[model samples]
Target chain A: MAASNEFRTCSVTGLKVHLPAEALIKANAVVAVVFLAVGGLFGLLVALTRWQAVHILPAEWFYLLLTAHGADVLLFWVIFFEVALLYFASAILLNCRLATPWLAWVAFALMLAGAAIANVAVLQGESSVMFTSYVPMKAAPHFYVGLIVFAVGTLTAVGIFFGTLVIAREERTYQGSIPLVTFGALTAAIIAVFTLASGAIILIPTFLWSVGLITTIDPVMYKVIWWGMGHSSQQINVAAHVAVWYAIAAVVLGAKPISEKVSRTAFLMYILFLQLASAHHLLAEPGISSEWKVFNTSYALYLAVLGSMIHGMSVPGAIEAAQRKLGFNAGIFGWLRKAPWGNPAFSGMFISLVLFGFLGGISGVVLGTEQINLMMHNTLYVPGHFHATVVAGTTLAFMAFTYLAVPLVFRREIVLPTLAKWQPYLFGLGVAGISLFMMGAGTLGVARRHWDITFSDAPLTFEYPPAAILMMGLNGMSAVLAAIGGLAYVLVVVGSILFGKRLDAPDAERPRFIPRLPTTVAAYGSAGTLHVPGTIVLVTVFFMSFVLYYFVNWKYLSEIWPMR
Target chain B: MAITSPEKRVWWNEPLHRPEVIWITIAFLWGLLMFGMMVYWHVAGRQNLSNEAYKVFPEKFAEKVEDMVAKYKVREEGATKIPVVRPPPGSDVYVLSRLWEWWPILELEKGATYRLHLSSMDWQHGFSLQPVNINIQVHPGYDLVLSITPDKAGEYTIVCNEFCGIGHHQMIGKIHVVDKK
Candidate 1:
């Protein structure tokens, strides 16, 4: 085993001859990881401010931080990371380089400028608008312009992604079949295209409204279209999360699912139905006709959920099968025994999957229901649900992938392995604790974004049992733990980026392996691989979600509600 | 990483065969059971506490409004359940109508079933019950009927939950759940 240090330079072709596809994506991912870490801090601060018995910030400052948190986490952190992943799959994973390097730089510059504007406006007293900022709750014009600018940058980024795909197709690099990871990323990019398109549609008008160019914009219409952008972006997050999961399990663990086909098809389903699922957010809103609500909410969303549930069942099934193959004796949790708990990547993935299922998935389904939305709408439970998904699910997965990504891409070794090993556990436990506490408080009728609960010198009126107060306190403790865990993650990641050792050779070489089963089979597995028993169950679920949408609309939107 | 050579098995490939299949099935069944219990508990609790039998809307005061036709006689929409003016504030019914506004002029009763049918003829409004923190949407085409039963008699504020407009923060309604006069 000889360590070879060779400096590779640009060839006559004007591209680095030795740079691997994985290395490029991983490099892009590093920038995304840093941004996500900073944005997550803002997220944590906002949560603290919101949950503190008394707000941590002055009334005015509280609103500013709120704006920053939303802009950073919701818009910048998630989307940028997703874009990096998109580039990774399209260019590197698909054996191609970015179509135009200059366009990528332009996208980055515009996003950076937009983020600066949004942040500055937030810090200034001019933009105190809440994250929703729903028209008429005016913010400074720059804030809206900043949002528009950022969205435009994202559009350019997306154009580059498609360009890569076109270039890849033309080169015939994806000759046989698309890799599962690329397939998943392609689906996410498609979602992003629609998502960004909706953003341009809504935000340009909003920017004009902020500038006083438009005096009248119907709040209802803005809301409907806003979900097309806002909620659709979240769906992109969800799709990217699943795609990342497959990549981690297969690439890192050398584990292929029972079938690739099932996974790929599920990715397609996500593309088809994710946009429609946005109606879940508006289930309890007023003035939407029953027909429209029913069609979008119950029918379309349920189909998307069915796709999710299929993945939900199949992913774990595949993992269990993989564990058994590792030669662990068959017991209830024998698979756990064989699992590489010491490995940071494996542990993070494990914890992420568990939390995603137990917390995020369950909360999403319940909140998606029509009648249930009545209690849950605008409650702390709403944020709690998303936090579980975005932070615990997607963020954790990203952190886990970083264990492999940092070394592979930046040629840097993690500074402290021991700290790195425990980072996931600390963070995972803290997130789970916080989410649970939030869920409990939500059950007790805790509202969201209220500056003060003890209103008008009246005693704080609450209907929760005595136990719920304890839960709220627990929620506070969980917030503290989460803050600590988040701090640790930042330290570890930043330490590695700045001071970690450079890799020599083995890591530089892309390890070769046999092709797994076709993604279609890997997706669904031995069970029909297409029209399995699970498909029937999925169809029923799709219809049920469809019916639920109509039932809620019919009950809530009727001119004369049956209250006699 | 690139695939250089073909191998018999894929990297860390996990195949779901009979034994693994049986175990997954059992675990899924257990999950289903737990899910069912959670659903049952949630539904049962909501149904019992939220039904019309619990209380009526505007749990504070009682009112007897004149018929729409006569303006003097109590309008007979129908006569089934006797009008129970809880804490029996008065016979004068205060019907205040305002969108993006709240009904502050009201006398209340303790544990009285006053059918508070909240509706907005224009844009959507939110009627959030004070103390309980329960908020419902009020739309032009829809009426949100609430049964309010105040366990304690006191002055409480009803805040708007929906973002009606710039005045949403100030759109506060008052309800005095007075002792029987």
Candidate 2:
């Protein structure tokens, strides 16, 4: 039974914020940032080592750091932030108390402990088995145990989220259905459950095998089941980040989806078909039938891709519609030109949307094709594709949300506003460069996760094209630039939390977070006639690029030695 | 509106915008096209991954590779002692992947097709043929047999792209596709 005093009305957004939920969000977010810093540093080291010219770190440290980099960033940082998002979307948005605050704290403690244990195991030099672990290459037993513990903790937090949702419904916190962002969060949570379950199924057996209790862990079976968790976890990211895209549109521009049905249906498509895309990883592997590969990799005729395409249009369309209504109606591109590029939140979200669609979305579809995968499997292109999706798309979107959340959730004025304004572009451009260069190198047959692309110490020598080595050098430079941007983000966020002015204080001046619109402007269904011609043109360009790239990959495949 | 509940309770009944309808239709059709292309490629395309795989013991697979090497070893590759075996056209060729090397370098005549058998002795390895740019996942205990036709004559490098261990970068093999007379 939480007291009424435990809730405070936010000065901005006018949403009722639960104190416990806010604290939990803050704690989870801070820890997520901490992991991001550590992981980003490790990533920089890896990129430098991969650069043929620099070639820093011995072979042993390269693999070790690469493993740690993947774990800390992909698993710890992203999942921790998602847990915070789950809580935010449920309790705070619903204007209800978080279900079992004590239990939520316990979940957090377990996650912290799990993350620490995994890090320690990796640091102990016994668990350099990379993030996929791909059994038969046994890591420390504690590595598996730590991951299991982490997954259990995440599962507990998800339970609390669902419980809070129930409480919100029971208490009748608001009218009608849950908000679209919350619905999107629900989609992510559902996917998370599936992901965690798959992880438990594979990892538990692997843990036993690591301790010598089990023998003959089949490698093929490990990959099949492992990707069930591995790739599905990424699906969770897709759903969550799309939700953030929607949330940012609402907060920044007070924009509604052109049609709730259309948007919600797109999210529904993700839940139904996104997990099937995991088959792409196994497309080049044997022991899997071509029938299974074709069916699963296409996601039953690319319905999930259709879902992404929908978001690709609607997100920008929503923004365009909102801007048009605000009288930025000079031409098809006027609204975009007049957009709030100076605001980090708006700029970050917009950059994320565009780059994600162009670089990540297009490349992913091409790479996932069954035959096309033969050309790019285990290449630097794989990492290039993911950096675009996970880092540029999801992480940038999260950073944009943080710009809003710092003031709204943490109730602190952002420190170093000037640096914050430029952070997104700096980070976004650097990441885009990394993705492009890595893919370029991969196109030239540069192997990923190898210590030396030059193969300086190999018995039989092979030379990569000079262009591939050049791409690696550029990738290393981009990584350094991205690392600086990451550092700026950490400094701004931490500095604001510790030393910036408190918005909640009675004496403090509250800056208007959400700009006030005209009285006549309705919040929903106000974009009459939906004349988003700009977005239409944009998506058309995207379509053309996709068509070009998809066919180009097939052309590349055709040039390879004939195989069947 | 995304942050709050919908203004209408019956939100599903709302009409979709014309652009959304058009985009969805185009996107769905594009998806179908992509799917059709993959299926069509299987029927018409020359390059397709072979689904032929078998379960075998590591020791047994190693023995087969040794047999292939003994029967067809032309000469030792310069500097490295790895045997470069030239199997007959349309023969079953074996290449075993282990901790740090792809053993028994292969030689084939251009325009000659052969069933290439690949399996890892331990752990999983990626058989990434460079210059030609064909890659496949090789797993222990499972022999993946790909039908390979060297259409062009050149020296090809087999790069072990999968991270097997510390010596992964050093694990390289060669394939010589001699021109057909």
TM-score of candidate 1 relative to the true fold: 0.76
Number of the predicted model whose DockQ against the real structure is largest: 2
Interface root-mean-square deviation, candidate 2: 1.5
TM-score list, all predictions: 0.76, 0.99
The alpha-carbon deviation from the true structure for residue A64 of candidate 2, after best TM-score superposition, in angstroms, is: 0.4
For model 1, report DockQ.
0.09
True-vs-predicted CA distance for residue A120, candidate 2, Å:
0.9
Output the worst ten-in-a-row residue range by lDDT, candidate 2 chain A. Answer: A519-528
The CA lDDT at A16 in model 2 is: 90
TM-score of chain B of each: 0.53, 0.97
lDDT of 1 by residue, A123-223 (tens): 78777666676664567888888887888888888788888888877877555555677777778888888987887888788888887788756656677
